[model samples]
Target: MPMLGFLERLKFAQNFCKSTSLVSLILVIQSQLTLTIVPLHFSSSHILIKLSISALLLIIISGFSKCLKRLFGVSASAPALVLFNVLFVWGMHLFVIQKAIPSAANVGFNMECVLLMIGFFSILASDPGWVTDDCYGLEGAVGGTVSDAGRPCEALEVTAELSLSGGSFATRRIRYCKSCKRDIIGFDHHCPAFGNCIGKNNHPLFMVLLVGFLAVEIAYIVSSTQFTKESAIMGSALLETTLSGNLVVSTMLFSALQVLWQIVFLMWHVYCICFNIKTEEWINWKKYPEFQLPIQSQLGESYSEMAFINPYDKGISRNIMEFLSSTG
Candidate 1:
């Protein structure tokens, strides 16, 4: 028992360290960026700073937009909107809000920024479980003709007839993503913010991104409120004020609005995860026999009702585990 306990502790310690590695790396990069930008922000001429920030923003937008477009055929608007929101929030927090608050709170605020960036970049960079031609068996007898990806379903057969509730069953179909020109396993939906499809491989990271955004947006609203209160109480002039009060208020309101919608989205996704249902499946439940179960109506033997029931559900705990453990 002692040995087992020691092993469990060791495993937990390792997992904890692994989880924190991204935050540590982000802190290092954030420190370097702060060192480089702070001087330019304060000492440089206003026009020069504005031009530099604008140029950097454009470069980032262009680079991400081009990559997303090439890979997923997404337009520039997606990245541009998300990047602008992130930049505006982080800029206000770093330059404007932080000045009003105590230095100790800055670390926590910076950590939130790190989480948001890590979540965003991780989701953006991840593969969404795309199925390629190589996945098909080359040596097997042909069960189907060549697919759009030039891959044939092998002799073993890729399709399966899944049993659903109420004695209903359906042939599970593989979804082909037109944007990526590939089939996706456990496909969810195409996310404009990440400029990628959410699927088995990246859905967990997408959840993390939503959670991180929620945290940051809440912090933003709180910090904005604190700054307003402090400025009113002390009657102090805005420190190194570059943006106007209206811009700050507008950003805060935007974050507030995001919190509202994101909470709804996050809760819906939570329910979906618990029930092992995908957004696509939930929205198009009528199309999938697995999601429809027969129900007897009060009108008697001749009458019946159809209800939504997720066939893939394996109970909450196992469903959550399966989702987290999915690799492709």
Candidate 2:
């Protein structure tokens, strides 16, 4: 029995490593393909032709992404798009922009890319505080039984345990994620980009990744100004510009679009962190009693306001510290 258990664990580890490696390989290939294929095929094409090709490309990519998601998960789509964009920008900057004027921005851009990749891999590899079978066991064996589908029974349970000192206890609400088809501790949401659930363990890493992306996008847009200015000096409209000019403009457009949404995303996360709340909690505030309060209306009748009353908030300073200092 012990040997069988060991073999099962070994098989699981092998499968995990294979999946991670496969995704990483796909990201690298897709990024390199974007850098190579676009320039070879569409760089000198007419503006209308390029636009038509781009639209067709998007449709093809959408279909490919659906296939990948079926094979992998929803997380596959975002990472693939992100890595491709990063590589395309880097390639253009190196081959076209830097040829005219080299600056310290190259070093900064390279560092940000490295950091972004590291953060991306870290989040993908880390556990997101999953509510495992052991957690189910801790909750009076509530979901310990396997169902007819050959999976553990899906259930939610709040569990508390006494500390070794027996002076204090910690409470945790386990939520069953329908998408993941498992329970997660302090479940935030399943981030399709990260290809993981944003639970208690890896939420901080997700934030760090978000910040890294914001910085990289901003830098890419700012540094591309030199190239854009040179293109403008040629007195040609955007549609009639040279290949390098068009590539630079395209990258800037993408970066700008990304920055707009990313800023809003970052601000929303900051608010959640300050209040020690998850996105799931914020969106479904009415479902959780912890965020509810009784308020009287002008008519003197009382009703649940569903106002934000987060019991986990330990003040902004400590909340920030807790979020930043977490290793995951």
Candidate 3:
């Protein structure tokens, strides 16, 4: 994308072209989303519902603003996810919260919704380390395992600094991400939909986002899916609840399907956390053979050889705690 424009220079616009398209699409779809589910007289409750949707729409627009995009580049699916999350929240507010859907109207449910938003935006707006040409000079080789000034997805382990014509300074080899064409502080994977790397720093946030979405879905389904004579309150509406008569049911079902996949994703990451390894390491474990380090006796004579170990594993409890506590 062109970086010369006023919107591009702002940095946090989260991809100007994509965001603009997203906003345009939402404007076009607004009417369809508000279509009435059943015939009924206009009332004060319906007016409140409309106002709630308008407020939520404004919030969604802000999310697409330059603020987040300037800070952290957005994923390909970033706009869609934000839109879905906003609409989902609005649906609950209109159909369930407004009508007081039994136990669904409690503070706890409201809190869950809050967390759902936190995790959603936190994942999208935070920087996932991206590698760029600046990490190595133009002459450096790129991505080669053998050391050179610059290379693709690889760096030379600089044991010491060499005097240069320009100047001299201490240097070190950092992680290189070939796919992203940049050096990452702690490189992980480049998520295509997310349009960035899930590096060491932001991985945990992604985890929190996945789990939060799943948990919210579970709660939303349990309380809002019940059909009963309570439906009498809704008049011509099919069910007694807000969830029944509106397009909210479609949203809820979509959430459930999305959560099902997220459950599998969450389980995989949980195992990785317990084992103290990343998805990249797990996938390529066989390619990288493990070696044993020499062990020494008290007197300094060699006693035995220690097996290759996972340095990150500090036991399951410690591992979990460490990951949760990690800045990532």
Candidate 4:
């Protein structure tokens, strides 16, 4: 029995290492590809704006699709495609647009590295201890004994019902999640791009990345002088010229569209943060009532309004440590 226990422990350790290593490799590949494709000298603002639009669309589409998949028995691949597009665009920005040297591209790369490091450390610091089933088959709670499906049960009495009404479930147990041990707190669906759970500890980093990336993209767009270049070149021509009018109209339209899109995207993030809600949780309103109306209305309240405003405060850290220690 002792030898069997040792083997099982060793197997679990091996599996854990394999999972972590695979995730690290994928992130490294993604970062390298991003740095390779995205242009280093393009207007930071333009790049930032484009990327932000793409990310926001991906998040919304993916979040809704995931919810739909759970509600209906549908495939989750459609939403996954949206997520892929967002990551692909980001990779292009890093690799093609950003310069290899100490330029905007390098800055973006460094920021990504820092965010990824934080995510890595957060995962490591989290505890993976949890309960597990003994048998490899289904065990239904019929009568006092929990027997495998093969055994004939007297009646199907719901002794301890565990339903996946909102979340994903495989058979009788909650489906395995790579990063989190159980149902994530303030749970957002898994981010395949990040290859991690966007839960309590890492949600801050996700928000930081979203805001920082938008800022960087906006800076790039403004600095690139896309509009200025067009204006300056077009000014040399006659005012009444058809080409001049076309240039002005086109530039104006583009600028308006860009500004509107950025505002909408930024506002969405602000709303999520203020409401203390995850994108997934917000979208799946029926699933999470804690964030819904009446009980926790005034969803637009800012972080300052919350009792624990400063996440990085020493007191907050101490409390977290104490909680973890006790739980451990």
Top-lDDT candidate index: 2
Sorted on TM-score, best first, the list reads 2, 1, 3, 4
> Looking at candidate 2, what is the lDDT of residue 290?
53
Position 175, candidate 1: lDDT? 52
Residues 1-328, candidate 3: write the lDDT tens digits: 2333234235544453466556444542442243332212232255345444444544565564545467765322444645455555555655554454655455566676777667655555456644344445532533335346445335432211221111221121234455655566444466653445676568787777667667767766555455222444334444333533454443444445556667898899889889777665455443323312345656766576454444446699987886776553
Query: TM-scores of all models?
Result: 0.64, 0.68, 0.56, 0.34
Clashes of 4: 29
Cα RMSD of all models vs. native, in order, equals: 12.1, 6.9, 12.5, 13.7
| Candidate closest to the true structure, highest TM-score | 2
Residue 207 error, candidate 4, Å: 0.6
TM-score, predicted candidate 4 vs. hidden true structure: 0.34
Evaluated at residue 114, the lDDT of candidate 1 is 80
Total colliding residue pairs, candidate 3: 25
Flag the better candidate by TM-score, 1 or 2. Answer: 2
Over 1-328, each residue of candidate 2 has an lDDT whose tens digit, in order, gives 4465357446544554555445654754553344333434555566455445554554575577678778867434454556556767777777877655556888878788888888886776456766545543543434344456433434333322221122221234455566667666667788877656787788888888899998987887777767666656234543565656656755655566667778999999999888778788678766665556646465765543544566668899998897776443
lDDT of 1: 0.62
Give the candidates in order of lDDT, highest first: 2, 1, 3, 4
Superior candidate under TM-score, 2 versus 4: 2
List of clashing residue pairs for candidate 2: 75-192
Model 1 Cα displacement at 273 (Å)?
Answer: 0.2
Tens digit of lDDT per residue, candidate 4, span 206-238? 555555544544543442244335444323344
What lDDT, from 0 to 1, does candidate 2 have? 0.63
Residue 27, model 2: lDDT of 54
